[model samples]
Target: MDGDFWAPPPDVSPPVPGVSEGYPGVSQVMSHGYFQHGGVTFPGLLYSPRSLEAAREFPVEDDDVFNVTYQKSGTVWMLEILSLIRQDGDPRWCRSVPNWDRGPWLETLLGLRRARANARPRIISSHLPVHMFPKSFFGSKAKVIYTVRDPKDVLVSLFHFARIFRPYRDPGSLGDFMDKFLQGDVPFGSWFQHVRGWLQLRGRENFFWISYEELQQDLRGSVQRLCSFLCHPLSPAALDAVVTNASFAAMSHNPMSNFSLSPGFILDQNRGPFLRKGISGDWRNHLSPEQSRRFDLVYRERMEGPPKNPSGDTKIPPGPPKNPSGVPKSGEDPQGTPKNGGDP
Candidate 1:
């Protein structure tokens, strides 16, 4: 396994270094099993050894559309947008099922089954890095839309999110959380590595990149571009509907879009909303100047592939070739492998 794929936090002592098979000491904070695989530890609540194994072998379809992101980087928002486009701007159909059901996480234990049972041309989502996806994914014509947010903002949003779990207690001060985040101690591992890994595959025919900042700043344009990439272009009126339906305010209130309604599944409703303050740069309110400077130094050193833009414009150049048909071409499996799938 590549070193970049492993995420071992410095503060939390992992089990004996050589013990690679069982769950590590359970995290008191989240009350979830923490397991180590290939020397990398991840929360068992979302990923288990079985699920990981399943994901590595998961079958992928040519029409499969994956909305990939690190947690809290507008996964739900992109999901809603894709759902609407798939439904041809029919909000009723999009809301007919829970958002989770519409676009299930691909790495969770049951994610693959749920995604497979859904209507043809599934819109699946995952937090797994590019390399972590099943080998079939790389060879298939499946489309992947990876979303990224400024790490500073991701840290702040994740900090508040962790506090919501009863077992997690308060996340201490922002400074403490910032330190852990900078060190890749948080859930999904190093933000730098995650982004860099995916960014490295930017020019692939089936890969598309979008930034949360860009989506927030120009949702209509972003949605239009996204729809085109998915080969599900919409009319001006339909595009308007998608933008309206996917707005933060609308989704925050919708039970389907907000995880708060799920109760024990993920959110502790009493804590707060999952769609908390969707804007970028909110990190300024929490991270001190010194903390920000330190994070910047590390980010510059680690985040090497994509160029950073203040306005969040990380759009790839247009006119990349598209898969003629979702079907297997040559030397590809008729039915791609299935993988364990889920979000952080």
Candidate 2:
């Protein structure tokens, strides 16, 4: 189970002498569940050094649509919209297949295999940082949809998420999680680093940058824009269908979309639903005044955001930075032929 993977922060340091399976509600994550690569922390239960390395080398067909996001940053929601768009606003697929399987992840071995074997116009998802993404992506015409959310909201969502997601070590307390989050100790590493690194690349023709607030405020408009970017425009009727079905209230009731299909060991449904409140600004309710002040201070200090961009969930600056930084520098692509699949 340990053939090279990202080492989650909870157990980065040596574990206590006698704590079996880690002390409950403590910060010690099991060794088997993590792996480290290029100083980034990934939940390793589904990943491996070989797997991640392979994904980096995977052949990225021009038809690939990567939904890249940090956790709880509208990852699932965006998938839902994309899935509906792929289906031309049909709910049949959305109601049958789980979103993860429908839009597989690239960091995990399973996702890698599924993707390699998948047909064209595949919807690939990932939480990987830019420097570690698939190498072939740079040379290919694969379109990427990157979503950002208010860090405060992300913090609140991830805190509750940790409670229900078994792969994550207990977040301890809100204060503890906040300390680790600000310090880049959570899964997928520093929010500041992840966002800053990707922000530098928002200008690319193939990349579409969107904020969670934009989605919340105008889902229909956002979906329309995504549809346009995908070059798969939908009719007014079809577009309306997509907006209605992808709504939080609509998706919450859909067994396939809400991740209700997840097994008990993977997700403790009794503790909470996976698609818990799908709104923005919920952080205000969870963060205390002092905590908010502290978070704002850290966010402002860490993020060298575009000028005049509000600190948290910094909006994408009007235009791409002078020299946008995206796609990690690497050697040439492998000789393997990328699999082909038609539009979904």
Best by lDDT: 2
lDDT of each: 0.66, 0.70
- State residue 192's C-alpha deviation in candidate 2, in Å: 1.0
* lDDT of each residue in 46-154, candidate 2, tens digit only: 6667776777788899999999988888998899999999999998999988887889999888888888877788999998876667767777789988887778878
**Poorest 10 consecutive residues of model 1 by lDDT?**
1-10
TM-score of predicted model 2?
0.79
**Positional deviation of residue 263's Cα in model 2 after best superposition, in angstroms:** 1.6
The clash count for each model shown is: 19, 8
Encode model 1's per-residue lDDT on 207-299: one tens digit a residue. 777668667877887777777677776888999999899898888878778775676756676767778888977877876677777776676
TM-score against truth, every candidate: 0.78, 0.79
- Candidate 1 residue spans exceeding 4 A from truth: 1-32, 166-170, 305-344
